[model samples]
Target: MSTDGRSAAGERAHDATGIAVEEGIRSLLLLMPRVVGRAKKMHIPEELQSFSLAPRHLSLLANLVFEGPMTVNDLAARLEVAPTTVSLMVGDLSRQGVLERRTDAADRRRTIVGIAAAHEKSVNDWLGGSARAWRAVLGPLTPEQRRLFVDTFHAYERELG
Candidate 1:
């Protein structure tokens, strides 16, 4: 045990930035649940409430909502998942009438997926709160800082895996 009140293992938890790793872990543990709970409480637009969309679907929808139409390969690349995985999600949403799939004009073999016109507003409304919240938080950050923040999140996610 150390005078700092940490066990020897804990005493070794200092990060390169000089902040204790345990402190960062404690802060995130206290903060993450509240953030996730608030996000889970966000209202699903009436038109979308029937689809029973899950969290996995959000990243896919967000990509389409923010970046416009793209092929499944593009979405899979951006989502960092297998193309078959994205294809299944796209197929499911398409059947639900939440997504539209059309052959890419530039490549007949390729299909471009997009939010269905009828559901676009609903998807936008459903995701708008999160987008605004992220923008509000990240807007003031320097580009480098924003990159670091995002990279840190990626590192955390990979570590979890």
Candidate 2:
């Protein structure tokens, strides 16, 4: 028996696995602050500034860009955020002229959101820099380590869901 009360065998197994998991999590946690700080410091053009977009906003925009127009409820589901949160983000982006919102013709009561054409060039520019920064951040990691890191995070997300 261990001091914490688990059987000796169980405690040994759990502690061994727990230490590795905690060490991996700690390394990843340490990396995030530096990556986020670097990302925020990276330049985005002044014209795109009014778009009032942030890295967090990119997920919604990317969904729209890749999946075409979608209703706020659908977007909220995809983003794993509350409908009200999606609505607020939509409202802000709409006011900034970063996105266009319209009542879906198929369902008059449902509003669909899509990216605005005017910001296409700016979005592309911003995404290019963002991608480069991410690549640079991961450049030091071994291929297997990088893949494992991404896979672990995805697994964590799936577990949460």
Candidate 3:
């Protein structure tokens, strides 16, 4: 071990910095649910009310709407949820006729879930409108500014993860 880089003072400073970063991250994570709650009050549709919907549901729906069908396990991995949880959520959505499950052509053992035909247009419209709103809000930013914003947000996400 190199002694020059292992001073007691350096170790204490590093510990203090780590503690402060963790506290800051904890505070930010705590605030996220409140922010999501406010946004839901502002924009979530009445049709989704019976499902005890959360942002996680919106996230799942959006992913399916935009990215096309995905297997329950793949979706769980993307959403950072358990496979059983995803299966339950997909089962509920399927029951509501919002999602449809189909056997994957290449993988007989896997079931791919996607928005039902009847719900496709509505899902696309909602996501499109949200995209429009985001564009309106952030469109004025220069390319450099937009890049910086994206980079910083991704860095924040990495830290939180």
Best by TM-score: 1
What would the TM-score be for candidate 2 when compared with the true structure?
Answer: 0.60
lDDT of 2 by residue, 83-137 (tens): 9999999898989888898889998999989878888667666666666666797
Which runs of model 2 end up more than 4 angstroms from their true locations?
1-30, 54-56, 128-151, 154-161
Looking at model 2, residue 58 earns an lDDT score of 84
Taking the tens digit of each residue's C-alpha lDDT, what string does model 1 give over 18-98? 767566676788999999899889888888989979887999999998899999999999999999999999999999999
The full ranking of all candidates by lDDT, starting with the best, is 1, 2, 3
How much is the lDDT of residue 53 in candidate 1?
Answer: 95
Query: Which residue pairs in model 2 clash with each other?
Result: none
> Which of candidates 2 and 3 reaches a greater TM-score?
2
**Residue ranges of candidate 1 with Cα displaced over 4 Å:** 1-19
Local accuracy by lDDT, each model: 0.90, 0.78, 0.76
| Model 3: per-residue Cα lDDT over 1-161, one tens digit each | 22456554444444533554445546767998987685555554556546665666787887786678999988898888899998988988899888999998998898889998987777777665666766786799999988987898889789778
Q: Which stretches of candidate 3 lie over 4 Å from their true place?
A: 1-38, 45-51, 134-151, 154-161
